[model samples]
Target: MKRTRINKYGIVACAILLSLSKVTLAVDNVTPISIPMVANAQVFADFTDDIPAVLNYFTSSTKDEIIDFYNQSFGESIFQEKNESALR
Candidate 1:
């Protein structure tokens, strides 16, 4: 039937377009470094510790506008003012 032919043509055209649309990725010959499992987490903690003061400054600055904030409500502090404070 004419309807069967039209459906076959549509299917063929869709298949051709789908195959042509994909592009193969070409990469350079560079070796990727494998980091330790805890490396990223440790690095993130270090970064968070480094910027505690800046984070506190921003949090304290926005205290009034923000209600029911975890950092202010639960009183759980992150990052110390100094390395000595972190020891205690």
Candidate 2:
């Protein structure tokens, strides 16, 4: 009976190890998204590991120019709001 309990514990440990290895492999296989950046912008911070990456930068370009750059890079139509925000 003691041998049987030891065998069961060993099997359970192996199963846990195998599941953890699979999870590690899945995380390693994740492909990172390519982020488009504005030209000549000074980057403050970048959080690429997040689900949707965050980029903070400062640019001397006008708001319209920045909007045009993003629209061209993303290949999507974007509109500027009266509050000085751009949305796709």
Candidate 3:
């Protein structure tokens, strides 16, 4: 009974910590802008493709090149992290 109680408390504590971390990370990284946002205002028509060829034009090396390009283009202060994940 005591062990089960401890496990429940431990899980709750972990969940709380994880949520707090996410909140802090988001808040710390936010930049203030003067613009109030509008919802889904599109200047261009939507794509008509059944299966969109997103990123297919980009070669494998384009991923790394994109990161480098953005870092150079934006001068690194606005962009802090680059993370890439792929599933087989």
For model 3, residues 1-88, the per-residue Cα lDDT tens digits are 3554367888899999999999989777755433211232332433323234211222344445655754676557654654455432
**Candidate 2 segments exceeding 4 Å error:** 1-4, 7-10, 78-88
lDDT score of residue 9 within candidate 2: 87
Q: What tens digits encode model 2's per-residue C-alpha lDDT throughout 1-88?
A: 3554368888999999999999999889777666787778998987766568888888898877887898888776756447535433
The C-alpha stretches of model 1 lying farther than 4 A from their native spots are: 1-6, 24-88
Best by TM-score: 2
* Whole-model alpha-carbon lDDT for candidate 1: 0.40
Q: TM-score, each model?
A: 0.20, 0.66, 0.30
* Candidate 3 steric clashes: 0
Candidate with top lDDT is 2
Every candidate's CA RMSD: 15.9, 4.5, 13.9
Model 3, position 61: C-alpha lDDT score: 45
TM-score of 1: 0.20
